[model samples]
Target: MRKWLPLIAVCAGSFLFLLDTTVVTVALPRIGADLSASVGQLQWVPDVYTLVLTVLMLAAGSLADRWGPRRTFLAGLVVFGLASLACGFSPDIGMLIAARGVQAIGGAALAVTGFALLVAHYDGRERGTAISVFFAVNGLGAAVGPLAGGVLTEYFGWSAIFFVNVPLVVLTAVFTVFALGRDTPARRGRFDLAGAAWFALGAASLVHGLTLGGEGRWTSPVTVGALVVSVVAFAAFGFVERRPEPLLDLRLFRDGGFTTLVACAAASTLTFAALVYVSLWLQTGRALGPVAAGLELAPLAVASFLTSTLAGRVLHRFPPRVLLGAGVLLGAAGCLLQLGLAVPAGLAVTGIGVGIAGPATGAAIVAAAPPGRAGMAAGILTTTRQFGQTLGVAVLGIAYQAGGLAPVYVVAAGCGGVTGLLALVPRKQARVTT
Candidate 1:
C-alpha cells in the first residue's frame, strides 16, 4: 500500500485537473446568474480553461522535459490551487474567465507530467496496474464532475465548486513532495517559443471568432478580423513548426494512422461539448435545479465509467479500427437519438460509445508512434482532443443560440458520423491493442 503513494499523488492531481474540465458544466447557470454573465461569457468560463490547456499542452510537455516531471507537477499543483482560490473569489464573470485560463496553465503541467511520473516510478506488472488505475481515476473524474458540481452548487453555491479544489491540491502536493524522487532534467533543448506563440494565437482567435459568430456577430468587424487572424496565425504556426526543434513536430502528420487517431480524438469530444448545452437546457429551459439536471445527466457519466472499465478488460480482443469506428458510430447514433425527447437515453448511449473508444484510441496512438516520438504523439493527441472540445463548445453554442437543442444535436451527430467513418478507413500501420 505504501509503495503506491506516488501513483496516488499523481492520480489525485490528474483527477482534479480533469474534473475541472466538466465540473463547471452543471454550475454554469448559477454562475451566469450570480455573475450577471451573458451566454458568451458563460461559454468562456469552460472554454478558456480548455483552450489555454490545449494550446499550452505541448509546451508544458517540453517544460517537463527541461524541469523534470516531479518539479513541474508540484509547481502545477501550486498554480492550480492559487487559481482556484481566485476563481472562488471572483467578483464578476470576466475575473472568473481570466482565473480559469490561469488554472489551465497549471492543468497543462499536471496533464503532461502525470504519465511521465508514473512511467518513471513503476515497471512491468506494477506499471501496468498503475496505468490502469490512473486511467480509471481520470474516467471517474469526468463521470463524477457534473454530479459533484450539482451537489456542491445546490447546497453551497457555485463558488464552492472552485473552492473545493484548494484542500485537494494541498493534500496532493504534500504526498507528491514525499513520495516522488528528486528531479533530473532530461533535455536541454531550446523551447519553441515561436511555435507556441503562433499556435496559441491561432487557436484562441479561432475560438473567439466562433463565439462572436455564435452571439450573432458574424458580420461584425471584430468577428471578421478574428477569423482572418486565425487563418494567418495557423499558417504561421505551420511555417514555424517546420524548424528543426519545433514545439510540435508537424512531421508526425505524415503517419496516416496518427492523423486518423488524432481526428478521432477530436471527434470524441464533440459530445462532451454538447453536454454543456444539455445541462443548461435542463436547467433554464426545463426548469430543473442544478442537482436535478445533474441527476438527469447521471446516466451518461455512470454508463461511460462502467463501459470504460468493462472495455479496458477486453480491449485487447478487438482491432483498433473496429473499436474506434464502432464506438464513435454508436455515439453518433446516441447523438441522433437526442434529437427527440429522449435526453437521458441518448446521453447514456453517447457515454458508452465514448467509453468504448477512449482506451483503444489512446493505446493505438501511442503504439503507432515512430520510436522516440511517442511523447509528442501523446501530446498532440491530448492537445487535439482539448481543442476539439473547445471548438465543439464554440460551434455548438452557436447552434444553440441560432436554433436550439435540435440543431446542436444534429451538428454533433454529423461530426461524429464523419469522424467515425474516417477512423474506419484502412491504413498501413502495425496492429496495436490496449
Candidate 2:
C-alpha cells in the first residue's frame, strides 16, 4: 500500500488539475448569471485557464528540471490551491478570469512535474502500468468534470466547483510530502527567460485573436493586431530556441515519432472540446438544468473511463502509430455521428476514441525523449494539448455561433480526420515500452 502512495498523490493532483479543464463548462451559466458576465466573459472563464496553462507549460518543465520535480510539483499544489480559493471568492468576472489564469500557472507546474516524477519513480513494466493508470485517471478527470460541475453547481452553487479543490489540494499535498521520494539533484542551467517570454507572447496572442474571431470580430483591428503579434512572437521563439540551452529544445521536433505524438496529443483535446459546446447546447438550447445537461453527457465519460483502463493494460504490447491512428479515426467517426443531434451516441464514440489514444500518446511522447529530458517532453506534450483545447473552444465557439451544432461537428470531424491520418505515418522508433 505504501509503495503506491506516490501514485495516489500524483493521480490526485492530475485529477484535480485536469478536472478544472472542463468542470467549469456545466457551471458556466450559473457563473455568468451570478457574476453578470457577458457571453464573451463566460468564454474567457475556461479559455483563460487553458491559454495560461499552454503558455507556461514549457517554462514549468524547465523549472522542474532545475528545481527537481518533487519541489516543483509541491509548489504547483500550493499555487493551485490558492488560486482556487481566490476563484471561489471572486466578486466579479475579471477577478475570476485572473484567478483562473493563476490556477493554470499552477496546473502547468503540476502537469509537467507530475509526469517527470512518474518517470523518475517507475520503469520497465512498472513504468507502463504507472503511466496507464496515470492516463486513465487523466481521462476520468476530464470525462467526469462536467458531471461533477453540474452536481456541485446544481446543489451547492457554482462557487462550489472551485471550492471543492481546497480540501483535495490539502490532502494531496500532505500525502505527496510523506509518500513521494525526495528529488534527485537539480540540473544546473540558466533559465531561458527570453525564450519563455517569446513563447508566452505568441501563444497568448494567438488565443486572444482566435477568441476575437469567434466573437465575429475577425476584421477588428485588435484581432488583426493580435494575430500579427502572434506570428512575430512565434518567429522570435523559433529564433531564441536556437540557443544551446533554450526553454524548449528545437531539436525535439526533428524526431518524426515525437512530432507525431505531439500532434495526436493536440488532436485528442481538439475533438474533446466539442463537449463544452455540447454542454452549453443542452442547457441553453435544450432548456435542461445543469444536472440534466451533465447527465446527458454521461456516456462520453463512461466510455472514456472503460476504454482508457483497457488501453493501459495493453499499452506496452502495440505500436503507437497503430493505436494513435485508429483512436483518432474513431474520434472522427464519432464527430460525424453527431451531425444531427445524436448527442449521446456521438459522444460515447468520441469518448472511446479519446480513451484509446490518451495513454498511448502520453507513453509514446515520454518514451521518445532522450534521457534526462522527460520534463521537457512532458511539457511539450501537455502544452500542445492545452493549446488544442484553447483553439478548439475558440474555433468551435465560432462555428456554433455561425451555423449552430452542424458546423461545429463538421469542423471537429475534419480536423480529427487530418490528425488521424498524420498519426498513421510510419514511425518505427515510436515504442511505448522497452
Task: Note the clash tally of each candidate.
Answer: 0, 0
The clash tally of candidate 1 reads 0
Candidate 1: tens digits of C-alpha lDDT, residues 1-434: 88899989988998999899999999998898889998777888999999998888888876776778899899999999999999999999989999999999999888878866766677555655565566667666866788899999999999999999999999999989998989776666788899989988999899999989989999999999999999999999999888876677766677676677788878888988888888888888999988888888787777777777666566667678788888788889899988988888988898888787776676675556444343354467568778999999999998998898999999999988998998888876543221
RMSD of each: 2.7, 2.0
Instruction: List the pairs of residues colliding in candidate 2.
Output: none
* Model 2 RMSD in angstroms: 2.0
- TM-scores vs. true structure, each candidate: 0.93, 0.97
Q: Which pairs of residues clash in candidate 1, taking residues 3 or more apart in a chain or in different chains?
A: none
- Model 2 agreement with the true structure over 80-109: per-residue lDDT tens digits: 999999999999999999999999989999
Provide the overall lDDT of each model, using Cα atoms, as 2-decimal numbers.
Answer: 0.83, 0.87
Candidate 1 local lDDT, residue 102: 95
